[model samples]
Target chain A: MENTALEKSVLNKRKTKSLILRFMVWLCGILTVGILAYILLFILVRGIPNINMEFLFGEYNSDSLSAFSSIVTTVEMIVISLIIAVPVGVFCAIYLHEYAKRGNKAVKVIRLAVDTLAGIPSIVYGLFGMIFFVNILGLRASVLSGVLTISIMILPVIISSSEEAIKSVPDMYREGSLGLGATRLRTVFSIVLPTAMPGILSGVILAIGRIVGETAALIFTSGTNVLENPTLDLMASQRTLAIHMYMLASEGLPYSKDMAFATGAILIIIVFIVNFAATKLAGRIGGLSNGK
Target chain B: MESIKKSKFNDTVMQSVFFMSAFVSVLAVIAISLFLFLRGIPAIAEIGFMDFVFSEKWGPVNTPASYGILSMIVGSIYVTAGAIVIGVPVGLMCAVFLAEFCPEGIYKIVKPAVNLLAGIPSIIYGFFGMQIVVPFVRDNVGGNGYSILSASIILGIMILPTIISISESSIRAVPESYKEGSFGLGATKEETIFKVVVPAAKSGVLTAIILGIGRAVGETMAVVMVAGNAVMPLDKIALLKPIRTLTTNIVTEMSYASGLHESSLIATGVVLFVFIVILNASLSLIKFRSSRN
Candidate 1:
């Protein structure tokens, strides 16, 4: 009787410990989700009321209406940078995936270079932009300089992600196309590229998100003057939304706090929209693959 | 024969384009390195390297334009160290629970949350820190609104996603056979995890930590907001006082700076670049060794 009771108690203790362990795991998962939700909710609540059409379209003034110039500048930079980066990045990804063999030293060097570039700090890119584009090339605080700098900053991300996307296309497709007597270029451009388009689009969107949100690189390369709707001239320095928000928060002028918060809200919305679009595109691609 | 010749020509052209693409990326890296080195060397040569690195006075605009990056470097180290201290354990534990202990439904939710965290911009993080952390620390820690402690906390939060994701992947990559073997030896699940799995994933975990360090070191906007921007290095008495980091110092001073001062700030960039190069090389080496082993 004594042995039976002792064994029963030990079994009961083990059961309780296991239950506690299970509960702890559930609690951790809940806590992580809770914290993230809380942060998103807090920002949305604080920032939403401040966002308005005036805020999106108005000129930048410390005293009067909201600064929309920053938004325009940001969009311009994004367009210009994408114009440069996407073609180059896609071409590079194609080169790596389609043409290069496995054992080439040049391929190895390129891989290492891209990895290292991705690891380098944004501020260093900004510094380089300052010296090379602004000084030597004489872009002089223009949107062109910002575009050049940001292109280099996000090039690795675009290339690597697009390369992965392209590589994920099965070898069977390539073989079938070639067996049909199609040229390699024709095979890649039609069969592989279209199939990889969703992934490439997703990569581009993510890169755009990074470009829109970036501050450090822009600060040095793009001059922080808040102009109202900049023109095609690349030499004029312009302020982006992030730079505007930083300036407002740090400079401590009148009504700057309100403007900064409002700008932050706009930035959040823009980023959220871009991120949402990218996620949706990725999901659609995933679904298509699953359907196959 | 004609068709064969055409195909060969096409292959050559495509191959050349591939080679050129690869070469351009390498050229970019070389150009960046060269520009930074050429612009930065003059300032370092003028300042005498040791004093430039170790001295505390950072004012580059006063009578003599005294500039030493010592305090900023210390501040960077202090904050990054604090962030690592807070981030690693929590992150590792979270990773453990996620990989080893969680059920499928729970994993689904938790995984997306981590991804979202990783996706959020750093500027928003800075805003969050300013609005939440700074006020909380000022009210609770008996300091003014900005301090190294606040910066550290924010950084800790910022780096958590990286740590959790990387560590979780590593822990998951731990072979299942090890777990079965441990179980067969009459080990409990907890013992199997703590003993067998974590050890197997040690190098990966170490890599995660190194990556976290790199993030913390390179982070600028968030640190700029919370670190109070003290130009000079603080004494022990002023540990809670705000101080500049190397990145922050460069950002803060670059606007009004001219001549050697501007060049010295760029030199700061050189220092930052060197640190990143060292970090990348070490990480690659570690990864290489780990794979080989």
Candidate 2:
């Protein structure tokens, strides 16, 4: 009788533990969903109403914080930064994956450095840019400084992604080109690069997303003034959408609050679009690699 | 013969180009380190290390200036702890749910939502926190709204994406045979998942939490917007009191700061950098051990 009673108690304990875990699982899942829904809805509802034509295309009026010039600066920075970052990042990735010998100390050092760079805070990048580029390089507080800083910031993302892409290409492709008596340079450019193009493109796209949303790094390098000079000149201080929103929020202008929200909404939408495209590209590449 | 020579020359050129590209990352890292330390160390020496770290007062503009980072250090620790407490359980469960329980249709929606959270910029997060979270706190708990609690909530939300994705992948990567073994022993599905799969993914879970901590500690803009940027230590256990963190201390003052004050802020960045380095080293150590296993 005593053994039976003990067994019953043990069974009850097991049941109670299982029930609690199950409840936790359901509760946490629901909370995640709820919080995500609330944030999305809060931003969209508050921001979408303020995004009129004037906000999108209006002239830069400092008092109002219209985002047109900010948007323009965002696009220009993206272009300039990408121009500098892509070729270099892609080539670096290729050297690591294809050319560098395994177990090489220099290669290991480079990898560690890149990883360290990746983990540093964005604000640190701002500090470094403020000191190195703006002060030391005599670039001053201009778009050029911002572009260089952001390019370095995004370099790790580009290199890591491109390296993975290049590594995924089967060795048989390289071997076949070599067997056909093609030079290594011709084989990589003509045969390997085309195969890895989709993946590289996706990496570049993600870099664009990062460049557009970046703020702290841009805070000092890019300067705060939203320029309406309507030029691609890199010397002028310019504000991207993210910085514009930050400036508005901190300065406590009652009228410009909605404008900040509106810029934020647009920024989110752009990031969402870029991320979607990236995942789709990555998925297609995954499918292709599996098929091979 | 001429063509062969030409091909060899082209190969050399391309290899050098790629090598130079690879060298740039290393160059940038060296440059950053030299600049940060070269400029940061002198400030500490001039200001006195003990005074810089221990003094509770921060008055750079005063006639007799004082630079103490103890409060901000405590504040960073407090807010990060709060974030981990609030974020970890929910993030882990959500990860488990995603890996084990979600229906395909629901998974589709949930997955993208998490990704979008990551994709959204911190500045946008700050706006949301400022407009929504800050006010909501004021209405409910009532401490001027921008407080440690506010920073914690925003940061906790910010970290969810990192926690969920990493943990989900790690959980899914657990060998199927382990689960089957647990099931054959007459354990329930929840029991097997909790007992078997979670333990197998333990290191990965730790990595996720660490990564989340690193993110929460380093986060600046969102925290700045909601944290209220008070430069004093909390006298009591109050989440509603505003506090300053290391990253925010640097960004807020760096705009106008000059001379020793500027270097002190950079010195603060030095401290932040050291914290991140420690976190990264621990992460890589875990990774190294796991790979060895």
Candidate 3:
């Protein structure tokens, strides 16, 4: 009888301990979600009121603090950086997956370089950009300098994602193409690339998201100069939307805070759209690859 | 015969093209290191290596000007340590919740929320810190709004998605047989998790923590806004006092900095670069060992 009573008490203690741990787990999960919700709502609620049509499309001046020029600059940055980074990144992925022999010294060197690139902090990239692109190369704080810097920064992102997409291509596709007398180049172009396009494009979209949001790297290279009239000149030093919001906030003018909040709201919306599109595309890649 | 030969030549050419493309990243890495060292080493030599790195004074405009970064280095370490303390436990618990305890319906909501958190830009995080966290700290805590405490909280929040996603994936990767074996030994679910499953995923969890450290230390725009940009003396450094990190030190002065001041800022970049390289090497080591196991 005494032994049975002791056993029952031990069981109760174990139950209580498990219950407490489970409660802590739930609490932490809730806390994570709660913080995200708070920041999102806080920005959107205060910012939505300040974003008028004029704020989005009007000329940027000391008075209105419009964002139309910055919007143009952001788009240009994305397009230019993608144009340079995507082809190189995709080709690098193809070489790693299809061309290089396993355990090759060159392959190891390339892999290390890619890994190193990925691990580098953005501020370091900024410093490098300032020194190499701006001063040595004489690009002089132009969009071209910034674009070159950002292109290098996003190369790893593009290469890794494209490599995964390329790796997922079924071996049978290559075999069947070769069996039917297609050349190696022909098979890769017609068979592998077409199938991997969706996945590669999804990666490109993610890189676009990175380019759109980048600030630190661009600050020293591209600069925060706002163009009174938006233009496509690569030589012009212009600020993106993120930089605009940062400048407005840091300037500490009386009205700049409201404008900064509005600009931030716009940025959040763009990011949400980009994130949604990438997720959808990534999901489609799995389906298309597996369904075949 | 001619067609096959011609096609073979085409393939060779294309392969060379791809190889050159792969070499670009390698070239970029070399270029970055070379430029940083070349620009930075001269300044470090000029400042006297020991005085530059270990001394506390950072006055750039004084008659003779002193350029020491010991305080900024300390500031970086303190904020990173604070971030690790605050972010790791919460992130680990959340990971456990998602991997083991979350229902399918809740996972859908939580997963997207975490993704959105990762997608948010650092600039926006900085702005949010400027508006919300800094003010909150000033009112509730002892010192001014902009202090080490505020930067830590923001960074801790910022690193959450990184730690959670990495940890959750590694936890899920733990083989089912391990959990089943623990259960068969009469271990309850919670006990099995903390004692058996988490221990099994130890290397992966360590990787998550290290990556979180990398992010916290390298973070710039957000830390600048909340860290008050004041170069505090080493003895004066406190949680509630304004402090400058290695990253913030460069940015706060880079604009107006001229001559040696500019070079000194680049030297600061060189120091930050070394820290990242060390972190990266350790990460690779962990990955290599785990893969071998």
Candidate 4:
């Protein structure tokens, strides 16, 4: 009878401990999710009521230039930065994965440099942009300057991500192609790249998200002029959504406060879509490859 | 012969372009560092390096335009230290909970939520802090709306995702055998986790803390929004008083600044750059040592 009572108490204690552990995990998860949901929900609640089609696709009012011009500039800057960054990032990834040996000193140096760049603060990047691109290159707060600055900002992210993707392509495929008498270049381009395409696309999308959200580097390099839309003239000064929102709050423009919230909502939505799509694509590709 | 020539031609060009791209990417970092150092040297020499660092007055507009950055340096340390004190323990505990105790479904939901936090823009964080944290601190902490405490709270929140993610990965990497061994010895799950698993993952946890410090120190927009922009020092425990950090000082003053004022702000950039370099180097070293072990 005593032995039975002891067993019962021990079992009860075990059950209680499990419950306590579960509760702690749930609490941690809830806190993280709660903070994110609060941020998103607050912006949507405050901003969505104010958004309209005109806000999405309208020209700037001179009185409140930040709202309209910033959207246009962000898109133009993304396009230009991608043009420069994507090619360079992909090429560097290709060299690191395909050409460079593991122990090569130059490869090691490149890796270190990329890692350091990834760790460097955005503000320092802003200073560099101000000195090199804006002042010395004399681009001077133009859309072109913003493009150059952000391209560098996203370079490390793209290269590292793309390299990981490329590296994940199975060695069996490479060896099989070579055994079948295909040239190394042909094998990499046709077999490996297609296999790695989904991962690379995900990396590019992530870079897009970073570029759209960036503000600090843009503030110094891209002077806060709200041009209506991008033109062929790269020298035209422009404002991004983030920079516009910052100006609204910091400069204390009462009229444009709602507009800033509206833009913030839009930016968040855009990032969410990109992140969701990239994750889905990568997951699908991963499943298919593993199944094969 | 023609086909062979075409194949060789393409290979050579592709290889050269790929190699050059990698080389250029590396060169970009070296070139930027050299440029910043060179451009900043004249000003540092003019101010005397010690004065440039230790001076308290930062009026870059007056006749003399005092360029002391001591207050800004103190402000940076205060906010960052405050953030570390709050963020590190919560993040580490959360990471431990996720890795050792959570169910699979909960893990999936929680991990992505952390990722989402990381994905949110700094500007959005700034706006959130302005609307929420500023009010909370003013009412509860007995301060005005904008304060260093407010900035620190916001920054702490922003850095939580980074700390949690890195630490969780490290904790997960702790060998399962260690936990199993403790369990066999009649240790409770909590005891095993605290004694064995955490000790094994100590280096990784250290690395996460370092990364968190880096994030808190480098953060600009959110800190600037809530830090009250007051250029003067406050009295004892001045949560309500405005403070300026190095990053904020540069951002706030760089617009209308010219000549010596501009140079001094650039000097702040130099100082910030050096601090980041040291932080990153240490982080990398920790990461290297941990991975090797």
**Which candidate gets the maximum lDDT versus the true structure?**
3
Docking class of 1: acceptable
The clash count for each model shown is: 0, 0, 0, 1
DockQ of each two-chain model: 0.48, 0.75, 0.80, 0.56
Best-matching candidate per DockQ: 3
Q: Model 2, chain B: what is the TM-score? A: 0.97
Model 3 off-target regions past 4 Å? A1-4, B1-3
TM-score of each: 0.93, 0.97, 0.98, 0.94
Query: What tens-digit string does per-residue lDDT give for candidate 1 at B37-120?
Result: 999998988987986887887778788877788888887888889889977876777788899888788888788778777767
Candidate 1: segments with Cα more than 4 A from true spot? A1-28, A230-232, A284-291, B1-11, B237-239
- All models, RMSD in angstroms: 2.8, 1.6, 1.3, 2.9
lDDT of 3 by residue, B116-186 (tens): 89888898899999999999999998788899999999999999999999999999999999999999999
Candidate 1: clashing pairs of residues: none
Model 2: per-residue Cα lDDT at residue A139 = 99
Candidate 4 has a DockQ of 0.56
What ranking emerges by DockQ with the best candidate at the front? 3, 2, 4, 1
Please give, for residues A1-292, the per-residue lDDT of candidate 1 as tens digits: 9999998898677667756655665565566677678767777787777777777776555554466777778888889999988877887898898987889777889999998888888888889999999999988888889999999888897898789788878788889999998888778888888888888888899898888878889898887787655455677788787888888777665467667777777777777787678777767666655538
Of the pair 1 and 2, which is ahead by DockQ?
A: 2
Preferred candidate (TM-score higher): 3 or 4: 3
